[model samples]
Structure formats: structure tokens, C-alpha cells
Target: MDSEFENQCLEQEENEEYEETESSSVQEKNNDGETTKQLSPREVNTIFNSETEVCEYYRQYGLQNGSGIMIRNTRKIDGVNTYLTVACHRYGEPNQKVVDSLKPKPVVKTNCKARVCAKRMDEDNKWHVTQFDNKHDHDLSPSKAHRFRCNRKLTKHAKRSLNLYDEAGIPMNKSYNALVVEHGGHKNMPFSKKDCENYMREIRKLRLAKGDAVALQNYFNKAQSIDSHFYYSIDLDDENRIKNLFWADARCRATYKEFGDVVAFDTTYLTNKYDMPFAPFVGVNHHGQSILLGCGLVSNEDTITFVWLFRTWLTCMFGNPPNAIITDQDRAMQNAIEQVFPKARHRWCLWHIMKKIPEKLKGYKEYDSIKFQLQNVVYDSIDIDTFEIGWSSMISKFNLENNDWLNGLYEGRHRWIPCFVKDCFWAGMSTTQRSESMNAFFDGYVNAKTSLREFVEKYDNALKDKVEKEVNADTRSLSTTIPCVTPHAMEKQFQENYTNDKFKEFQKEIVNVKYCECMMLQSDEAIFNYQVEEIQYVGDSQTLRTVKYNVVFIKDMELEYEVKCECRLFEFRGIICRHIIKVLLFKQNVFTISSKYILKRWRKNVKRCHSRTKVTYSTWKDTEEKRMYEMVCDAFYRIVDLAAENLERCNHLVGTFKKLELEWDTNDKGCSTSIVTKPEYFVKILMVNVA
Candidate 1:
């Protein structure tokens, strides 16, 4: 029997009887052309009993048998395009020879009961079950399958690989003692070699990073040293701090020699760290340039502090007292100046004095009234008694109460020179304004966060820059010369035709000449309106013609000369422009200042304190020197109160408070002490002018 016949016999015997329906039955033809119908129950049973016959049946049927069918769940296969019927057979050639040539292929059968070879493929694509055949788990009972293999040579080796607790051996990780010794109490580590290797690599990388940081820090330190070295040069011992005062003193001595001292003093704050608060003191000479005399890192701001600072500065810079010390009328500063330099003529800045008038009278309702009264006090050319009467009248008109601040401020009335109240010779030199500008410049070098060393360095650099600028400017001014003789010399050289005598007399009678301190001639753009009657020789009419000349001075020394009769000298040569030459010669006998030259306005003579039984550096013995630096905690505590008192006084300030009221006329000078124009007008004018 063939394999198909045997399989049919087996099915018949198992089912007892089988009937083939039209849909279920299939027919096959033998190679000899014999046809066969569906098998009977007994025939199917017979086919299952004999394998060899069934193999022979496949040979006759021309179909491959006993070859495993490769069944793929079509839906499970990737990219399947159509659905499959589960019971249908797939198309392929079936031959017994082909089946016999096929070899058994190993298959992995999961969750099988047998332990030896796991599984294999037979004639059908079904699993031939086997069991786990691993000999590593030899300790397990033959009937049971619960045991699992611990795949390591020893307990210690297993612990090293898996980081697990082993009952049979010591742990492979570092011992507690070893860890403590190596890591200095940092004991965290995994047991496995792989984890340890990774941890060690990370530690090495961190160490390298730290080394790189250290190298960069060293390089930065070297670079900083190189940068600071450029501005630094060691000369005299610690003399950089004192250089400004030294240069200023030398310049002052050179310029003014025996001239009276006119020192204007001012002080302003410098912000820095608490340990080094620099207080800069600025002094100005007659020429209006500021001299930085001394600075202090004071812990407090008070009378004593000011005294110390002033004494140190004056002693170092002048070696004696200044002839005059002008400052704002601060009571503490006043007292300090009087006590220290008793001989110096102390004058108050007039701007500060007038700024106090509005400060004392707050009850004034109308700004125009305050302004008109104040203007009379400042601008009117009146005697001192008349000014006092006008001031009293203002007090009554304003209905303001007793104003002690003003009285106290202007107590020594003579000391307050009202330079700006009315235009004076020294119109611009009333206040320590230039000193205030210097103060602003000094503030740029120090801020609240600046360190002590940075403050000193900035101070030195600023002083150096200021000194260089002034020296260069002075050198430039010295190199320039004035053309004093150009006009006058020309008239002399022209002689007879120009009528040197007439020209000389004409210069003396008609022209005005002025000279600058720097010996420069002054000429301004001007226009003159005049008609010449006649120019006739009084002594000799035979030699001279009766010519009339009308001359007018125009912009930039240009002159227009019209002669009644044609005079080629005045017309073609434009000789009128050289009229100054005739004037210079006429004054050859009498000294005449240049037109551009004006005498420097007088500075109030400052007094120098005499070195009476002098106090020298050696005089300060050890005890006194120590006392000078003794910690004054009390002074620092009082500074807060002092500052608060000043603010409180300013709060009730009549002048400042009155200015704040909107009803106060903005244009009134006394009502508005702040020197600012109305913004609306300023902007409108600016726009119109610019357009």
C-alpha cells in the first residue's frame, strides 16, 4: 500500500467508517494511468499500519510525501496582501524521492516536557517535542524540571560577575578595609569588575579636568601680572600717591612766584568698599585748573575728619598755610579751617550764599515777587546798606518767619563776595564749580564695589592723565605768539605818502587797544557809522590835497574807507585795514595794552598760617603717633546722626521747598534756584532753531 492509502486506512479505522462528500473527496491517477477513488474506512486503516507501503504509494502517485510542509501564517508574515483559509492546503510538488532526500531540521520547542534534544521537524510542519538538554544542571532530580543552572565556575566567580551574595565564597568586590584605606571613607562601589572599571575611568577623567583648571588658573595669574606691569614703574618710595600734589605745587610756585595765594577748596564723596571710602579733596589755583592735593580713606565724615584731611593736605602740598581758603559755608568745614589754618583768609562762594536766600523763606506764595526782590539784591549796583534794606523789605513782603539759617550763613557778611549777584570782573569764579567738576571726574575712578587696590591704581592713573593734559596745553599756549605790531608797523614803514604823523595822531585819538594776559591782541566783529567831513593839511596845504575819508569797521577787522576824491592808497591798497599799525606807533612812547588783552580778574588774597613754633614730623613721638590712629568708634556712630541732621534741616529749607511749588513762577530766579530753563521753551526753541 502507498503512504496515502495507509493514511486513509488509519483514518477509516479510527473513525470506523468514512463517507466522502463531493466537496471533501479528491481523486489521483497513477503513473500507469490507473484512476483511484476516495478510500474506504478499512483501506484508510490499512494505510496507517504500514509505512513502507505508504512510501511506495507516494512513488506511484507522483507526489512528494513525508516532506515537511513549510506552513506560514499568511497574516503573521510581514507584508501579507491577502487573507488565507486555515484548512486549505498550499500548492507544491509532492514526491516520495524528494521527501526521502530531505534531512531532519532542528526546531526550538518552547515549554516542552522532554529535556534531551529540544525538538525537530518530521514529515509534517509540526513540532517533535524534546526537553532542555543542558548538563550544567546535573544536581536536579531526574523526574523534576524545577532546577536552573548557575553558570559560573565558583561562588566567588558568580558573585564577581552578577554582584550577588554567594553562600560558598567571599565577595569578589573590594573589602571594607581596603575601600576605607584607598578612598578615605568614601566606600561606595559595585561588586562586578565591569562596574569597577567604569567607575575608575570616571575618577581619572575628573582628576584630569581638575589638573586642566589648575593650569589655566596659573596662566591667568601670569597674564594679570604682565597686564599690571605696563602702568607700574618703581621710582621714589611709595611716591605715586603724592605725585599730583607735588606737580601742582611746583607749577603754582613757577607761575605765581610772589603772587598772593587764592586757593578755592571743595570736597566730594567717592564710593568704594567700606574698608576704603576715598574722600577726594580738590583745590584750584588762579588759572582755574584743579589740583588734587590729598585724599583719605576715612571711616567717618565729620569736623575732625575734615580737619585731619585738610591739615595733611596743606602740610604736604604747601609746607605752610595757603593765603586764602574759600569753600561753601558749611559750619563744620568753617570751624575746621579756622582752627587749623587760622591765618588764611576764609571767603564763602557767592553762588552758595545766594542759593541760601530761597532756602530760608518758605512762606512766599508768589514766585515773581521772590524773583524781583532777589534780583534787586544780586544785580542792582547798590551799596551794602541799600542791599540789607532791600533784603529786609523782601522778608516783610513774603510774610516769611524768622529765618535763622540765612542769618547764620551770612553772619560774616564781608566774607561772602557776591560775584554772580552782579556781573563782576571775576564773573565766572564765584563758586568752587571747577573743583566740583574735578570731583565728578574723581568719582569715576571709584564705585561701591571697587576693591582697595583698584581704587589706588585708578587714582594714580587719573592724576597722571590730568597732569599730562595740562602740561601739553600749557606748552601749546606758550608756543603761540600774538601779531601786536602788524597794523602799527605797516603805517610806520609807509612814511611820507601814508602821512605817518597824521596816521599816528589819528590812531591815538580814534582807536581803542587792549592786550590779553598771554600777550595776544583782541579784535572783535563790529560795525561803525560815521561820515568824514574833510582831511586837510593844517601846516602845509601846498604839499597835501583836501581829501575827505569816511571809514567804517566791519566784521573780522575789515574796514570800508570812502574818500570824497579818488585816493588810490585807500581804495586799491585797502590801507584802511592796517589802521592798527598807526595806533601801535603812536603808543610807542606810551605803553598800550593789546585790544584782545585783559588783566586777569583779582582773586581774594588768601592768608598763609605762619610756622610759629612749628610742628615737625619728628615732634610726633611714639605715644602721640599711636594716639592719632586710635580707633574712634564713637565718631563713626555719630556720623549717621550728623548726616540725618543735615537732611532734616534741608527738609524745612525755605529756598528748596518754595522752588518745588508749581505756583512759584518758573522764571523767577529766587523761586527757582536750580539753574535750569523751562523744558518746553528750551525744546521749542531748539526745534525752531535747528529747523
Candidate 2:
């Protein structure tokens, strides 16, 4: 038994010695074998898919091969996700080994003529097939020449190569000139008789002066005023006997005799030259349209000058004692208006009043609170007594003053309200905006050099054309389905802007309302005969603290298509007012904004102007496509340079981006080439025996 046990132990010892020897040999073999190369997943994918390494691929490489370079298993080291992968290349045989391990992929060829196709020859050299593109047309046509011979022609790359030259300054190797050149000339069109006279005056100046360049420059400067960009005119006084001569006649009348006596006046500033200003005045008419009474050139916007100009215009045009007047919140202008038309109502413009509330209530912070209340005052939906209470509270909170320029009406409560005027139909027409449109239309005609005579001529022509269109439109409306609101209904809507007592006063005086298209009705003899108060009483009390206006509702004129006013609010918005709404309420089809009121006169003769010109090669032909491609490619390189500069500005941004994979791809054959789409594939042909 003792002998058998000893033999078993010896056998076990022998087996243990053999196993250790085998294990050591295996370890030695592993150490001797090629160092196991580690590669990034991105590098593996690149070699697996294709041979070419793009910007996205190069971005993946680590500095050296067989090193412990960290490979990103996922985009996020923490929380955020990245749309692209980033990796780095490892160098030497280990990287080569990684490349070798990847499955073989066939190299894809770019069939673009813009780039040469080359293949890897061993490691460093590249092999190319010269003139490979010329082997076949690849199309059904015998050649590219036959295919591009239609209306828009093109040359094949082979043909282009034959004509090429090497020039650095000329951009492309082969220069392509435009097929035709446009004329470098201009012509003057027919002008109105007054405009012709102006032109003749300029020509006379040019002919009379034979001087040095400086003198000639001065003469040309004066002569250039003949070019009126916007106005067209014909002279009745001319030898040619042109019937219509246009002149700047900014004059209108406001004959309001009803509801005691009242006249509202306002003025606004306009920019003619980029920085130069012009002031134009407006006189509110009972019709709700502001009458463009006059315009004057002022060096500065101040009260005394405007007041003098306005009083002179009123005396010359309408001649009278306006029992009450309304002006903008300008203290100087208001003071002057009061001095001139002492008998007039002398109220501040409601439009200007509303605009000033925001300035007065500076600490309120909430703009909507002020805007909503003022809108109610203008529209006349909210009760004036209630408005007073609300306004007083806001004024008290803000510590605003009644006499402050921004709160003009707070000192003149009842007089300035729309309901206080007999001409309630014209109540909402406050802003100088409506009259300003005419000036805007004519601003294109005048300039710094414009004389009063030239301005007058341009202004008259525009107004005459406008008035004539309005007159002609009446006939068309009668035939159309558009309706005109009865005058009674118009008065009713105008009443909405006023208080209950004011509406009662308007009803008491206005026996009947008339709806006449185009022509002003002479039937309302009472409107002219209504008593006017010559003596004016200046109220010591302040105006209402807070006034509210609203946009009552909008109505369409089905027949005439001319918007009518009910509250007379249209004049403020430059559309039909609420007075027109009264017209709509009584008769649904009273007025509509049809072709008559909205038709534009200037757009009529466009086709005639177009037909007079002839078509030619200069109008149609352009440069060759290859030249365009070269220009576009150069522009792209410039864009890339700019992008690089922009990136340099934000190094911190670059650091942020470095945390994620942002592989910029710019390896496509068309990266800098203008030929974007691929050409048709040409099947390789091997000569075969014919059947």
C-alpha cells in the first residue's frame, strides 16, 4: 500500500510540471506574436466602407499606433447626445493591421469631368487612364456636340480643352464673352404742357450759359429740377392749348354752420429729402375727409411759424370766424390757433390726445391699459362719465398733471369731445394723416431745388386726376350691386361717437339725411343756414381726465363699394368712418370700396409702354455655362475662407464643440465644382463578334 501511494504522488508531480511548461510556452508565443493593434470604430467603418478618407474620417485618427488611446464607445461622456461621431487615427503597423482587418471594399469612381480620376499604385503613386471620358458619349446621341446643339448650346470638356489657354487674371483658362451687349443710353417720354414749359426753361438756362465746368455744374443743378419723377401735367395757358394745367393748389373749404360753430385744424411734418422736413396743414370738413387747405416750407418745426401760415391760409380760402377749433397738443400751435380763430371750438386733436396718454402716464408700466381706454374714447362706446372716473384714478396714481403738454385735453374737458360739435359726422376725423396722403403721393415730384411754381403745377395735376376719377366712379356704382347708406343712417352711426345728450342735439337739428354719390348735395340748406356763434367763451375747467374710443364695427358697401362712415372714424383710419356706418345700418347696400373709389389711374397704360420696346439678342443672350461655373466655384472658396475666420472668433465655442463629434465633410467631387449633378454612366464596352 505504501509503494502504490508514493507512485501516485510522483505521477501527479510529473503532470503539474508538464502543464506549467506548456503554459509558459504559450505565454512566450503570445509575447512574440505581432502586437495586437487597437483601432477606433470610426476607422474600422471607414476602411470597411471605402478607401477615400474625408474630413469626417481624418477627424477620427489618434496620434500613434498600438497606444492606449481612448476610443469613444458612445457620444456622451455625460448627458447630451451628438448627431455625429468623432475618433482619432493611430499610426504605424498597428493602424495598418487595423486597416487590413477591415473587409475589402471596391473603390468608387467620380464620373465628373471637373476632377481627374486616380487610383492608388502601391502606397505613394497614383495611376490614371488619360482621356477616359472621351471613350464614348454615354448617351444615345453620336456625341455630346449633337446633344447640346439646341437653343441653349454647350461644349463638351474635350472640346473645351482644345480651346483652353492659361491666364491668371482672366479667371478661367478659356475666356467666354457675353453673346450680346445692352445699349448704354436713356430716353425721355412725353411730358405734360406745364412740365414741357419747365423743361424749356431748363434748356434755356443751359443754352444761355457758356461757362467753365464750375458754372456749368451750377447751371445743370438748376436744370435738373425739370425732371419731375411723379407728376404729369398739361398747360391750359400754353400755345399748344393743353386743357389741363397742374399747379400746387393745396386749398379747401370747411363751411360748417350747424351745431353752433366749430372748425378743427391740424398740421403734420413730412420728410422730403432724406433729412429735410415739410409741414402741411389740414382743415376738417363735415364730410369726414380732411381738406388739404395748404402746405408751407418751414426751416424749423415750431408754433409761431405754423400759426401764422395757418391763419393766412384760413383767411384767404374759407374766410370766417371758426367758433371752435381743434389742433394738435403742440402748445405753441394751440395758442396760435386760439388767437386766430378765437370764436372756433379750439379743441385739441383727439388723435394727438390719445397719442400723448402714454407719455403722461409714464409710470403705469402697462401700455395695454392706456391703449384700451383711449380706443374707447375715440370710438364713443364707453360712457364719458365712467371714462372720467377711470382716468382720474390713473392720473392720481401716476401723479400726472392736467396742464402737461402730453395731457392737453385734461384741461379742456367738454369742448374737445366729438359729441360737442354740431358736425358730429366729422368728429373722429382728427389726425393730419388723411390730408398727408396727398403730400406723400406728390413727394416724389419735389426736391430741395423745387420752386413754388413747379410744385404748384405737379400738385394741381394729381388732384384733378383724383377728383375726376371720383366723379366718374359714381356712374359705375349705380350699375353695380354696391349700396349707399342713407344720410339718416350715416348720422346715426356718427352719433355713436357722441354722448346721449350730444346725439339728442344732433337729432334735434338734423331733420333729414341725404345719400348722394360723387356730387355734394345742395339740398341741405339747413346745413349752411345753421346759426353760428361769433363770441367764444374760453373754458377755465380742465378736459376730461380719461377718454375712451372703440372701433365699433366694419361694414362693406355692396353697391358702390365706397365705405361710408357712421362714427366718422374712417377719416382717422383713412377708411370710412362710423358716420358711414349709420348709412350701412339703415341700408345694408349703401356703399362699398369698389373699382370706383379704389381704382388707380397710373397702372392703366403699362401694356402700351411695354409694347413699344423691341426684343433683340441683347435682351436674351447670356454668358456660357462653364464661365458661370468657374465664377460660382471661386465664390464658394471665398465663403469657406469667411467661415474659417468666423470660427476663429470663438475659440471657446470650438472647445465646447470638441467635447462632441462634429466631422465636417468636404470630400465630395463637387465640393468646389459648380457641376453638381452626375453625368450618365458609360458602360465599359469590350469589342465582341457580331451575331
Candidate 3:
């Protein structure tokens, strides 16, 4: 019966298409190939195979005649539709009281007596039109007929395409435009951009029908069940609604133990549907890759919220706080960091501070010169004395001693200035760019329309991709080797120890050895001082520039050799500068880089504990196969443990396993090999043998 109904519907659609084509061809021939006449309703004698055909026919008729059709009445007998009455949208009279309340507002009803009535025949099970009226007392608008709700409809295929677009973060207008092009033009499209938006809104409503908070909690619960190491905390308001949320997976927590010395925290991204700020604690791994340590969603950016998020994340990491942290210059964030991480060095992102130069100093008469001098004083100064002198000189020259912004910047200079913060290890980072880059990584998986539930799911997918990338890097580091560019033993030592990324950075400094000239300046008992001049290119012009750096070498019998450069690159970023390399290799004749200089965090062979944890985005079948394989392995482990207790028992067990393997091979050749294709099939065989 269902097949027959579908076949009739298809046939009816084909016939309607043919009639529409014939009518258009007739109009082209009659009116100089322009201006088609509106279609009229079917006569009272017309018959339909089913009641569905009657309603669809009149709906299309109304669309062609620039009228809206609606079902006015329906009669059923024995739980089956027997009679139907369809009418024009303006068939009823407007109520006087309602009309008066909405005075001057145009009413759609005009008491037009246009309708069609159909009755089902008891013998043939067909519908016959008993009454039809084509006359109307209202004006018609054929050009705007498609605007009617009854005339516009989206196919299942189109709805699916729109859903894909929405998931991929494409705008509704762009999705609609793409469909318009696919259909040849806007006029050929059955629905408008507004219709597409309405559909997407309905889709979001359906997705969040169970409430956002409940959906988020359910997702967190599922994640925890899959991985026992998954940690999550939610802060609720008095109404029991989630106000803040934080989560860190097993891998993230494990990674924090290795590279948690310098963390970049930022909250500039707020693209979710709830308007909550997305705060990601980002760190740099051995490969110089940005790794997520933890993430949070907060309803407010106040100190209390930040403190709560920080304490929660810290507890997840077993109360091990980072040695140093980087963030934007937010007063609330500073206060929170002081309270939660009192001993950790807090530095503001230099990029964020320097980015405000144009806004804060643009009003000066010599804005361009002032900006240049300010940047020079902030970046080029090598020590506190030099920075202070340059800052004072610049302020005096610009007559900006009274400037409040400059004074404020100077007061907080230690938080952002490079020279002031160079004593701590930063893992080659000085800004919140790591956190921003992490946010950019999520763009492909989420967007502003993403809900809390969707965000969590997509976040997992993104993190899984990140872990795969890290694994690929680890594989490359283990399998491949980059040849040293120089003949220096230190270069080769670094190449052999560091990952490809860090090796490249070391190579940059080592390769610059030729551009540096070292001269021994002074020497004291077991101490040597040297001045190194380096040739460099500056700005877009690539003009040759010469910069001189001081290097001091101390030879200690107990602690090996120690070399320090005034550039402070090694102290700040853990990368040995060219000056130190020149002073050691060229003058002091130190043949190899000391073990102290080779940071373990950048080593290639260190086995990270996080690599053992499985990511949470595997397919269901893969997960099941893995689980079954582990169970089988565990069973064999027990058998092997008992067998290994005595030599005689081990020998007997080995002999029996060899015999069983031969029997299984013989059975495989006799029966179909497909039977043993799945892990469960092999597990069943093992279970039978054990029983």
C-alpha cells in the first residue's frame, strides 16, 4: 500500500510538470513570447486518484493565480479521510472588534467566496471534485506568489545541504547564494534566503530542545565514562544553571607535567551562541607545537570567575602551577593570577602592549617618531640601565613627561618589557599568540552559532586532530634526520638531540657564525670577556647593520663551562645566541655544547607519558575492536604467567599452542576465512578453548 501511494504521488508530479510546460509553451506562442497568463482552477468534474492529489493541485493552482490556499474543513469516516474543503486564504470576514484594535492595519481576509470541495468515492476509492469556485473579489499578485508559505517548500536534499553548511560555519546568505547558483538563478529556487535562515533556526531549536545545560552535562558524563582521566568542573548559579565550565582531558593533564613551565592564557575569543568567553591555557611542547593544557567557558570576565577557573585547572593538574605565565594586560586577570599563583612570574603579552601605541600616542604632534622611539626603547634595550636611560631620553625628547599613558606604561614596564622579563624561561614565547593560534585552529570545526553541546563535541574532534599531528611529528623526528649545516661539533650535537623544529632554530644561530667577528677584550683569573660584532639586515630595506654584543665565559671545574651573552636570548627563549656560540667555539675553542645547555624539554627521544592515553574521538567499531583485543591479551597474559611458573608447564603449554595453531590453520583452509576477520570472532575461539 505504501509503494502504491508513492507511485501515485510520483505520477501526479510528472503530470503536473507536463501541464505546466504545455501552458508555458502556449503562452509563448500567443503573446509574442512574453507575459504568461495565470492558471485557472480545475473544473468541478475533475477527479483525483487520492485526497492528497486534490490538495496539492489546488495549492499549485493558487500559487499560479497569486492566491494562498488553505484547508478549510475535513470530514473523516471510520478513521479515514472521506471529504475535504479547500479555500482561498481571504475567504473569511474580519472581526470588527479585532479590526478596530489594530486600526489602520490592513487585514488579509476579504470574504472572497473562492473554494474547492472534493468527496471520496466509496466504491472506487477516488476523489471527485463536487464544487469549485474561481471568482474572487480581491486583487492578485502573481509576481509575489512565491512569498506565500503554502507555495514555498524545501526538499530533503536541500535541507541536508543546508545542515552541512551550518555545521561547517558557513553563513546562511552564502549558503543560499550557493544554492541559487546551483539552481541557475534566484527565480528558479523554491525558497528564499529567509527560508534557509528559518530552517537553520529550527534545526538549532531541535538540537537544543533538551536544554543547553542538560546537554552539556550529558556530554561531559559520556566523556568521563569513556576516559576515567577526563576532568571537568562546572560552577552553577543560585538557579542551578551553569555559569562557568572547565575541562582537561587525560592527554592535556599529562602534557602539562612536561611543558607547563610557561603558559599563555587568553580570553579574547567569544564566538559561541551563549556569549561566554572561551579561555584556553596554551603551552608549547618539545616540537614547538601549541598544545592545549586546559580550557574554560565563563559567563563573566571578572576576577572571581578567573580565580575559580584557575583554581579548578590547577587542581586538575594536581596543584602543580606553571613557573611563568603570559596573558594580556587585564587588571582582573592580574589580580586573579596573584591570588592563585602567587609565586609564578606573571608577564603581559608584549604584542598586546605594543599594539596600543597607535591608540594611546597617536595624538602627539610627532606620532610617527614617538611610536618609533617607544618601540626602540622597549625592544632594543639589553639591560635595565639601558632601558631606563633610553626611556627617560625618549620621554624628555618628546616632552611627554606629563603623559598619563606613558607614565602608566613605565610604572608597569617590568610586566611587558623584554629586558625586564628575560631572566625567566619562556619556551621561546613572549605573547598570547599561542592561545590565539589555538583558537584559530578551532575555526574549521566551530563558529559563532555553535551551542555549548556542539562546542564540546567539535572541541574533541579538534583536539584529536591536534594529537594526530603531534604523533606525526614524533614519527618524523624518530624516523628522519636533518643534516648539520656547519662542521661544528656543537651543531651536530644539537641536531642529534633536539627535534627538527628546535634544530632548525639552533641552526639559524649557528649558521650566523660567519657573520660575527669575536675579539677577546679582557681576561681575569679563569674568566674571559669578549666583544662580538654581528652583521644583520634590518627593516624592509634589508640594509646592512652592525650590532655588537658582550659575552662572558666562566670556567669552573665543578660546573663545566658557563657562557652568557648580553643578548639574553638563551636566558629568555632557551636558544643559544650567535654571540655566545662565537665566543665559545671561535675564541674559547669549546668543541661541544654542554649538557646543561641542552634543555630536556626540546629533546627528541623523551617518551611523553601523555602519548599512552588514547584520544577520545575514535570510531565506535575501532573502539570496540580495541577493547576486545585488550581483553584477549589480558586473558593470554594470565595463562602465560601461570605457564611460566614451571619449565615443564611452559613446555607443555607451548606444545599445546603449536598444535592448536596448526588445527586453526587447517580449519581456516577448510572453512571460509571471513569467519575470523573480526576480533570478536577470534575472541570467541579463545573463550571456547579456555572453557
Candidate 1 wrong stretches, greater than 4 Å: 1-260, 269-279, 285-287, 353-363, 379-383, 419-428, 481-691
What lDDT does each candidate get? 0.38, 0.35, 0.82
Q: How accurate is candidate 1 locally (lDDT)?
A: 0.38
**Which candidate tops TM-score?**
3
Say which prediction, candidate 1 or candidate 2, comes out ahead on TM-score: 1
Q: Report the lDDT tens digits of candidate 3 across residue range 98-170.
A: 5356466677788888899999988888999999987778766655667777888987658867866765556
**lDDT by residue for model 1 over 1-691, one digit each (tens)?**
6999999977765442222222224575744588866431122112222232332332222111111111222332255322221110122323334333468443222221211111213354332222212112111121111111111012332223322111111232543334434434432222334444454345334433444234323332433343321111111215322111111222223323323254556543454654434555455432345655445555444687667666765554545666666676677778888888898767776656665556655455685677666666654413466667776787687764465754564456667634212212221343636545766666545567554333444555566556555455444334532222335444233322222222333243333222201111333335432223333333344443332323332333433222111122222112322223223333222133332322122111222221111222111112332333222223323433444457554343433335444434564535653333333333333233322
Every model's TM-score:
0.34, 0.34, 0.73
| Per-residue C-alpha lDDT of model 2 across residues 328-386, encoded as one tens digit per residue | 56677766666776655555565556656567565556656655665544444334565
**Model 2 CA lDDT for position 122:** 36
In candidate 2, residue 404 scores what lDDT?
63
The ten-residue window of minimal lDDT in model 1 covers: 143-152
Error (Å) of candidate 3 at residue 135 is 5.4
- Candidate 3 has a TM-score of 0.73
Error of 3 at 473 (Å): 4.0
Worst 10 residues of 2 by lDDT: 682-691
- Cα error of candidate 2 at position 5, Å: 99
